[model samples]
Target: MAQLGIIGHKGRMGQALQQAIADAGHAIAGGVDAGDDAAQLADNCDVLIDFSAPAALEGNLHAAVGAGVPLVIGTTGLTQAHHTAIDNAARVVPILQTGNTSLGVTLLAHLVREAATRLGPDWDIEIVEMHHRMKVDAPSGTAILLGEAAAEGRGIELAAHRESGRDGHTGAREKGAIGFAALRGGTVAGDHSVIFAGNEERITLSHLAENRMIFANGAVKAAAWLIGKQPGRYTMAQVLGL
Candidate 1:
């Protein structure tokens, strides 16, 4: 059995991961929260799963590389610098990083990409997501993940073709642009929908997360799949063999 470690032991996701690891029949190497020595926990585990703050990511990557173990990063709201850090660290150790770990969401992104590819540029794409009230990030990472998928299928850069938070005299929607809307309230686990609007018809794809356990379970499964993998960057798509 794989010995799994948690990097944000006190957080909600971290707590849920504990139960998930047990349910998956894996051993818990240990866990660490803010100010805890992540290097210590990494040394004892075959793989690491991080659901911690963005500020702690660099240190976590360092610890994983030092321990020569794989890492699964489920933390969201990461900036470009954070991604660059992950890319650099991935050169030294296997790392599976994703905005959403749910298997359903992964497949949804695959479908979104396929749909975007088949549809003409005239179809406007919009992504909407909802999360718990306590969530700090707007547009939820899953929304961005889905937007990226659509962008890839359209052979465009999401950063250049994305729009969000519309208000006052926003004028007309740009053609071929991907729009995003975020909602927060009522302890919602998570909900995301992608809409493709054409001239006469509309198609919407969605995934609703009922609980954090789904994410926790997927993280554990990904951690197990990452063990002994070659040093490189990976995604949930790879984990699901999509």
Candidate 2:
């Protein structure tokens, strides 16, 4: 069994993760939340799992590296600086990061990419996602990742033609543009669907997360998998053998 330290111990995801680890027969060495110091927690565990906010990511990575414990990061909203920090940390300890930890969602992303590539530019791609009202970010990190997969499939840059919600007096959808839509209400775990519309038919690929436990389970699995990996960066796709 893997000895795990969970960051964001007070949050919903953190609590879920703790339960999932226990149910899987693993032991939690310690947990650190909002005001707790992550570096101290890292010292007591073989692996650190982060389900915290973007603000805490850098500190958690620093702590993981300092303690020589591999890390599994599920925090989203990462910026360029965070990416840089992750790269630096990977030089010292293994790290696995993913916007959505659900194994089904990762597989859905792969299929979306393949469909986008085979369908050609004639098909218009659009991504729609919905999450709980408490979600802080628009177009959630998972949506952006799905968009990136579609862009890669079409051999186009994601930044070049990304479009979000519009108001009045908008023009027709531009060629090669990928549209994104977000909806928040109730306590929906997550729902993402990619629509590919062409002149003849349409293809819709979707993934619905019914419970938060899927993510929690995936994170624990990732932490266990990172136990002996060499110093480097990894993704959920790699973890799931995609």
Candidate 3:
């Protein structure tokens, strides 16, 4: 069994992870809060799971690299530079960074990719996501993940094809742009839907997160699998054997 260390010990996700660790028969090495030193915790654990904010990512990644431990990062709303930092850190330690880690979402991404590939860009992809009112990020990380899958299937980069905003006087939808819409409010754990709109027809693929436990369970499983892995980036797909 792996010894796991949490980066955000006092948060909602952190509490969920603690329960998941117990369910998975893993031990909690320790944890760190906002002002606490993460590298110290990393030194005592076999793997680190970070479900903290974007502001904490750099230090957390550095801590994992310093201790030569694998890390699973589920924090969302990260920028390209943040990803670059993660890519660099993965050279020293195994790292898995995903917007969402639930098994169902992972499978949904796979299906979305295949459908986008077979249906052609003529279908016009769009992603919509909803989260709890307390969630700070728009378009939810799961939506972005699904959008990336669609972009990958189309053999294009997601950044180049993104259409995140449509407002007053917005003419018409771009031919190949991937649109995104986000909804906030209520106690929703998470919800994502990917729509492929074509002439006289539409195809939609969706996944709903009923509770926070699903993500916690997925993160725990990923932490377990990451132990003894080579220094590189990983994904939920790899953990789920998808």
Best by TM-score: 1
| Residue-level lDDT tens digits of model 2 in 1-242 | 97899999779999999899999999999899887799999999999999988898888988998999999989988987998999999999999988888889889889988998999999999999999999989898889889989999998889898999877989998999999999999999999999999998899999999999999999988888889999999988888888
lDDT of 3 by residue, 141-168 (tens): 8999999999999999998889986889
Candidate 1 lDDT: 0.95
lDDT of 3 at 172: 88
Give the lowest summed-lDDT range of ten residues in model 1.
34-43
| Candidate 1 clash pair list | none
lDDT of 2: 0.92
Quote each prediction's TM-score.
Answer: 0.99, 0.97, 0.98
lDDT of 2 at 81: 92
- Cα RMSD of all models vs. native, in order, equals 0.6, 1.1, 0.8
When 1 and 2 are scored with lDDT, the better candidate is 1
Model 2 residue runs over 4 Å out of place are none
